[model samples]
Target: MEVRRATVDDIDVMAHVLATVAEEGTLGTEPPVDLEVRGQRFRELIEGQGPSAMWVLEDGGRVLGNASVSETRTSGVLTLGMAILAEARGRGGGRRLLEAILEHARSQGAHKVELEAWTDNARAIALYVSTGFEVEGLRRNHYRRRDGSLRSTLLMAVLLDTSEPEPA
Candidate 1:
């Protein structure tokens, strides 16, 4: 598979993949995220007014999954978000997407990249950990379910610096 920067044409596929994964329930918990809202948000992020960046996994002329990074100099940080199609999980697509995002972040001179994942999502947490992101902290009950229950989240980060070697 090839990984590349995503163009506006990828919005619909990315949104569908993201919504499918978000609904699959990660780690040991499932959280409620408005799929329709997320689809719209994905569109906005790509065609959004603010600065944003994204990458996609391609094979057979399709965008199977995606990852994104957004930076704010005022915040001194680059935030990441990603999702692979449910059927594509267990493949290396997510990793490739993330690696491309890291390369882009480094190109932009970001100091660090961080993301939030549901605490119960062990697979994602493991992926982040192996990719050089460490668990920085936790937010208890950060996500509320549709019925009003709560789910916690783990904050993860990877520091980017000239002093460190890049991940292979």
Candidate 2:
């Protein structure tokens, strides 16, 4: 598998990947993903219309997943999100995409990278932990799912700013 920076041309496939992953309920987004809207949003990201960067994972020239990082409301902090088609999981695709996002974060002078994952998502949590992310907190029953049921998420973050603080 190959991980590379995304372009506008990748929006469709990226949307498809997102929708496919969403169907499994592993991701925050629910099924029935609106591809057109997602395509537009991805187009904006790929066009550099925001303080964000996106990357795609491909195998045999077909996109199998995507990862993205966007500047958070807090300066120097970036919010992270990623998804891989179920078929692509456990093949190092998630790791490669994560490596790309982390490298981008450091290069962009980010201080922290943060993400939220379902509390039950052990595989995802393990991946994050092995990659230097730590559980910061848990949001109890934070999300109301489409089924009218509530679910919790674990907040995780990795600090990238290891420099000494300035003198007071």
Compare the candidates by TM-score and give the number of the best one.
Answer: 2
CA-RMSD of model 2: 2.1
| Local accuracy by lDDT, each model | 0.76, 0.92
* Residue range 1-168, candidate 1, lDDT tens digits: 788877767777776676666677652324455656766766666775444677888788887888887764445478888877776677888788888878877777777898888887888888889999988999998777766878889989998874867697
Error of 1 at 85 (Å): 1.1
- How many backbone clashes can be found in candidate 1? 4
lDDT accuracy of residue 86 in candidate 1: 73
TM-score of each: 0.81, 0.94
**Candidate 1, which segments miss by more than 4 Å at Cα?**
27-40, 47-51, 72-74, 162-168
| lDDT for each residue of candidate 2 in 56-144, tens digit (9 for 90 to 100) | 99999999999988876788898988999998899999999999999988888888999999999999999999999999999999999
